[model samples]
Target: MSLEIVDSCVGCFACEPLCPNKAISAVMQPGEPLFFINPDKCTECLGDHDLPQCAEICPIEGAIVDEYGEALNPLGSLTGIPLHLLEQMREAECRQ
Candidate 1:
């Protein structure tokens, strides 16, 4: 499974350091700034812990999700972010 931070994120930077794989990154946007988790670096904390550290620390609910765009199940979770969203974000960033 993977994770993606939605636009609802307030850029609180709360989920940044919590990522064990150091996947989360702070990006400055035009309107509202937010954090982006690098799918390549993201491991969903699977090998490190039973839960995704970023999700665990995220104060905002529904901010993270799996490849199916469903909320990540905190129960014995895996690592990485959804390939689709990750690619989208990467492409968006590149265009910026």
Candidate 2:
């Protein structure tokens, strides 16, 4: 199974080097921002590590998703960020 880096990825470099398979690549295209993981190369660290390194190290919630496109790091799991606060922030951004 492969992990997908969703749009919520803020171009963080945290997940790059940690990838044992070297599947993660920094994508800095003018319009396409964020690091990308090559699904063909990604092994989810299955044979290397017990957990997917990217998901374990990602600071932002809902940034990394599984093969089924469900976020592995759902809201507030590691960061303890309140769901309401995130919703409010999104709403505020929409107003701007």
Candidate 3:
């Protein structure tokens, strides 16, 4: 359950650093910039928050969406790889 920023994003850059997993990045679009969430890195704030911090802090309503583009609500689309597995993978890759 990764969060995605739709085309409706106002480029407010509000969701970038707020991600605990460091999954969000800024991408420049034709007119306004957009934020991209790396699904591989996103943990949906699992093991950290009771809910997604991005959706909680976003000022623009409906700007943050779940993988299915549905409005993010509490307990919505909380799917992502387990944090421990991801960290183990990273550690193994770094050792190689």
Candidate 4:
């Protein structure tokens, strides 16, 4: 299966060069520019690496996803913070 690059990508250019298939590229869309992955060219790095290089290298959580629409780098993955803890912190801030 292939991976998809969602709008959450901040155009950091971190995943482009790392892709073995050269599937990811910058898309100049109006309002906000973002990177995209060519589904036809994407192979989830099955033959190249243990994990998808793009997702492994992407700094933004939830930016890269599988064909099933599941995030490869979900929230709290890079931050190492639990989702519940983050939510609690937000609630505490709101109460202050």
Best by TM-score: 2
Query: Any idea what lDDT model 4 has?
Result: 0.89
lDDT tens digits, residue span 1-96, model 4: 789988778888888999999998888789766888898999999989998899888888888889899999888999999999988997999999
User: What are the TM-scores, per candidate, against the unseen true structure?
Assistant: 0.67, 0.89, 0.67, 0.82
Worst 10 residues of 2 by lDDT: 26-35
User: Which 10-residue window of candidate 1 scores lowest in summed lDDT?
Assistant: 72-81
TM-score of 4: 0.82
lDDT string, candidate 1, 1-96, tens digits = 468888767888877877788888988889777888887888889889998887777765467887788765432243356767667876999999
Clashes of 1: 7
RMSD in Å for model 1: 10.5
Alpha-carbon error at 67 in model 4, in Å? 0.8
| Candidate 2 lDDT, 44-81, residue by residue in tens | 99989999999999998889999888888898798787
- Any runs in candidate 4 off by more than 4 Å, and if so which? 29-32, 88-96
Instruction: Give the higher-lDDT candidate: 1 or 4.
Output: 4
Q: What lDDT does the true structure give each of the candidates?
A: 0.75, 0.90, 0.76, 0.89
TM-score result, candidate 1: 0.67
Model 4 pairs whose backbones collide: none
In the order shown, what is each candidate's alpha-carbon RMSD? 10.5, 1.6, 14.3, 3.1
Give the per-residue Cα lDDT of candidate 4 at 44: 91
